[model samples]
Target: MKVITKILLCFFFTTIFFSVHIKAIEEEQSIIIEVEGDPHKHRQYIEDYHPLIEVVQVYDTIFTGIALKGKASNLERMGSLHFVKKSYPVRTYQTNINRSVPFLTETDDIDTEQMKFTGKGVKVGVIDTGVDYSHPDLSANYKGGYDLVDLDDDPMETLPEQGEPTLHGTHVSGIIAASGNMKGIAPEADLYGYRALGPGGRGTSIQVIAAIEKAVKDGMDVINMSLGNTVNGPDWPTSIAVNHAVDRGVSIVIANGNSGPANWTVGSPATSPKAVSVGASTPPMKIPFLEDSFEDKRIELAPLAGSKPWDLEKEYPLIDGGLGEEELPNARGKVVIMERGIVPFSEKARKAAEAGANALIIYNNEEGILQGSLDDSQGPIDIPVAAVGKKDGQWLMDHVTEGEYWIDTTYQNIQDKIADFSSRGPVTTNWNIKPEIVAPGAAIVSTVPGGYRELQGTSMASPHVAGGLALVKQAHPDWKPEQLKGALLTTALPLKNGKGLYNPIDQGMGRMQPQAAIDTETIIYNPMLAFGKIDKLKDSQTVDVKIENVSKETKTYHFELPQNTHGLSWQLPKSFTLEPGDKKNVSIQLSVISNMMDKGLHQGWITLKAKDTSYQLPYLFINREADYPKAMGLEFALKTFSKEEYEYRIYLPEEAKSVTIDLYDPHSLVFQKTLVTLEDTEAGVIEGTLKKRNITENGEFIANVEVKTTEDKTYNYQTVLSIE
Candidate 1:
């Protein structure tokens, strides 16, 4: 009797231990639970016992899952219950948004009224801050959506009194389906709103994951998430969620990041490998050119912030304010030209304004034309202010001594170029060439809450691709998410900057061409090749790319290798044929001889000339002198604690080599003392303290963070930290 009783007690203790363990895990946080059993059975069980488990969304077909908000302990308990498979805490997500007329041309003028595919029946999900569905441009196609932020059915982007409003979501929605005034890439596509991010343009990861699962469940053809956070690895929760969504026939597009001019800044979701990560590019300047007739030169004119336009018909007397010279006699009712250097542009404009000048022009000391912005608080000038390029301004000073010159402001057709602020890549982990493509992101005009806005960033670029995807989906209704992605990538146009051929690390295939993608009958299966880091220049390194002929007619493609092979070279077949509806894998060999190899990143494209048009595939070979340091440029908003003290966030992907935080006066162009210097610190993120030095006056101050990695690569990121 005693032996039997001991056995029963032992069994009972084991059961209680596991139950307690599972409860502990579930009690930690709210998690989404995926079950392998009948949806009806789980629904009944949830209804019967777990009253706190509020099922936000449910999927029965594509995958059986339930998005619930409950205690982590309870969630773990549910996992052990009948039918439950897994449960994990929800991951956070943030908002990302952007023009783009030339991008429309690149998309084959999809912005035009007569485009064949308008994404009429397709459902595109904008899973971000709730969208302003009431906006005239989006009202027609706003089918309806869910608001995960407020746990409501109406997914509306409501505005707050201060800070970034629902402008991001509204802007992203406009880029995909806005019509009437501000045209979108696919104005006729049906838009499904998902309010994951809240008013401040941020939301927890779980909210975003739930939204993605819900969008897939709702059968969204394409989903655009112009939001992300810096993630170290590809196995991040958001990345996994995106790949899972893609597996279930939903196309996902994400913004690579705005942390640009760097090597590996591609953030999570974009690093998913399945996602179409987009980067920003500058379209033709929207500003007009001013003719310097004396020098026979046409100089581009970028208006100063808070400046007015001048009447072009009248001519004004031009005066030269010597270097660092703003005050001059006979300057009233005349245009003053000041050379850049020795003083801030605002100060120059202020001095010129004080001297009673009619207008002000600051010539650049550097290469390109400078975009000047005068501080409004510095006092109003009541006259127009503009910037001129270095070369033209120098010529103006040398040629026109004294004369009443009439400046002609005429428009010019300039080619699109990569935006300097747009993030670059060689993605940190796999070096898999981020920013699969570039789009017009600078000065992009789109819808806001009450009116329209012209915003810039990778945030703006992602929507262009998202809108393009809707068009591609409408054209090929049966194409899978991967197929749609491959079509857009393979058919893109190769981009080159002022510096010459842009590396594959800078642009994946190139800027996207949606019109060509829709009309093309053939496509490449592989997105791009990332020959990560080859220590030695072997005889040859080869990768296989599968080509598919989706058309009814057999197609022949002739291979063309890059002419200027610096160190890398490819051996391609003279020609290849793909029968209708057939797929063939071609082995392209990339060889690098010992003498030709370089230390830094080596990148280029392999072009395939088809009968009608050509397709290009990008490849990267990174042979760094030293192992590249892992670093992430943080995105943070400054919060003021007091007049002297302010708090800024330091969110790092990995420990920094050293970080220096400093404050600068924009009006005076004075660099204050370095607030803090951290060396060999190992913290993922922190609310760092910054104290202002000699801040006698109260206004806005610019806080800059300079991060130097172990590899000597420096990342300079800044934000406006003000004392209100």
Candidate 2:
């Protein structure tokens, strides 16, 4: 009896320990980890987690996907990794998300009527190689071109232009305002040129800056800078130049970059705050996965994982061979994968030729592999070479796709989301936040530095935003870069940033929604421009327009400052023009400060205005703001919301320091009206809270917040009231 009892006790204790171990894992949040980049990296990462979490393997380099154990469903809507969207008229985009629609090629990606650029003579500058004047789709709209590279006539490349025909500049120009059968968002708009990058997509920040300077000087509405740099330095000329451009009323769009895993990283030019940054997004559709055997080819042109060569495309052919057969078995017209460092990737290609291979796949020595091309410095070799990670290489070894495989060959590069490769943001370096938005990067079909081709990277994504910016510009030509920036940022829709539970450093602010930004109803700072009024703004300079969102909610709208003003000088605007509750920024600049002498006395008062509220600045007739304290504090009480979302009430106690509230008055503190809650458990209550709180503020002031459901509907109740 004693022995049996002891055995039972041991079993019970063992059960308890197992239960505790299981519980610990369940409670832990998802974490990102870096391990060896080998073919077994993913397996090794999750090897110990067996019975804890089940994984759906997609690639060899893939360690782990996002953890969905307890995340929101909306955030986990990955399309390509799940379902795929149908191809757009141009091409199909694969995504794990089901609800996301494909590109606008077939079904309108955006409301065509909203474009508003029909007759508007706007010019979107493409600061690439140059615009192509010959492509069937882009010919008619080719206004004229300039080559910043050679600084000569015909920015367009000739037949002998050192690069591929795709570098003609027509493809990129088309994406901006493709005038062919498939209408571009900015159709009917003029195409401007500024050749920055050269063949094979290489250019300097100085050249890019020079292009922007020229575009601004020529008064182009939008300048498209669809290239970037991975490394950062003390002096970022691109960012500095961008600030000046915004101040000058020109909007610049820059590409993020192609490199991967760069947390908080963004491509140059795009990282510039004064410019709009763009990332990549997959096509919201299901498409074929184009694949060919690498072992059949002699040259490496696929990603590094494609270690072997295969014959499939038929476009390329093998000249020699082995294996005791008439020709090498896998050495015909297919991309090959070769290992780098073993006598150089290019030299390996030459060796493969002697062995009867047509293509080469050169992967990296790192635990994982990568895909990139080698320059022409090596001995003569003419075949496509592809690089990949070590892990991907091993996977390719297993899934050799045979002689031919169903692949979306037309599809772009690896849709693998990364951090270190993404542009870094909140960069104190340039004093600006970058990568304002993200999109699909791989296999990107956009304008190439030289011309037309499917180049992948954040480089392709930036042009999309620039084109969108042009469309926005057409709608509001008077909008200063500040106004446009505000609408884009505040109105951007939040989505899964990366493979992590939260936004991976790679995914900046969030995915940009072109339509949503243009239609939101909340009010951020509302500043009105008065050319030469009370403030005595310089006759030719821009007037600083200070605007702030006292409301504790997101707002979006279109704004425009006159572009005709000459000699304009004002800190154009903060890289982040839009603000949240209480944040403030200089709205406009009055160039009259001949010396710092007129700085203090210049009196051009910018009237604050918004499209949706009673938030308006009347003629200076209501300027009693001088009588009140610099700021007013709201000390009222109310109910609080307790659900996932919280709503509270604030009542302005009936004090008469001042009756009205104004945002512009130096002495009058403004309260964000949207945050004012009207909910009270009882039928009557006086509840108010200061919308913009600052610990450094002193003295006291009073502000009146009027609540209105509609423009003409105003409910004025000074007495106690219930906030139901």
lDDT of each: 0.69, 0.42
Q: In lDDT terms, how accurate is model 2?
A: 0.42
Q: What is the lDDT of residue 417 in candidate 2?
A: 39
Can you give the lDDT of residue 601 in candidate 1? 73
Candidate 2: stretches off by over 4 Å: 1-120, 158-169, 181-183, 198-206, 231-234, 285-327, 330-369, 372-388, 395-421, 426-432, 446-452, 497-504, 523-724
| Cα error of candidate 1 at position 648, Å | 16
Off by over 4 Å in 1: 1-94, 97-114, 161-164, 231-233, 283-285, 288-412, 498-500, 537-540, 564-569, 593-596, 624-629, 633-724
- Stretch of 10 with least lDDT, candidate 1: 11-20
Task: For residues 213-236, write the lDDT of model 1, one tens digit per residue.
Answer: 778877899999988865544656
Minimum summed lDDT over a 10-residue window in model 2 is located at 13-22
TM-scores of all predicted structures: 0.68, 0.47
Model 2 C-alpha lDDT per residue in residues 339-359, reported as the tens digit of each score: 456365545666565555556
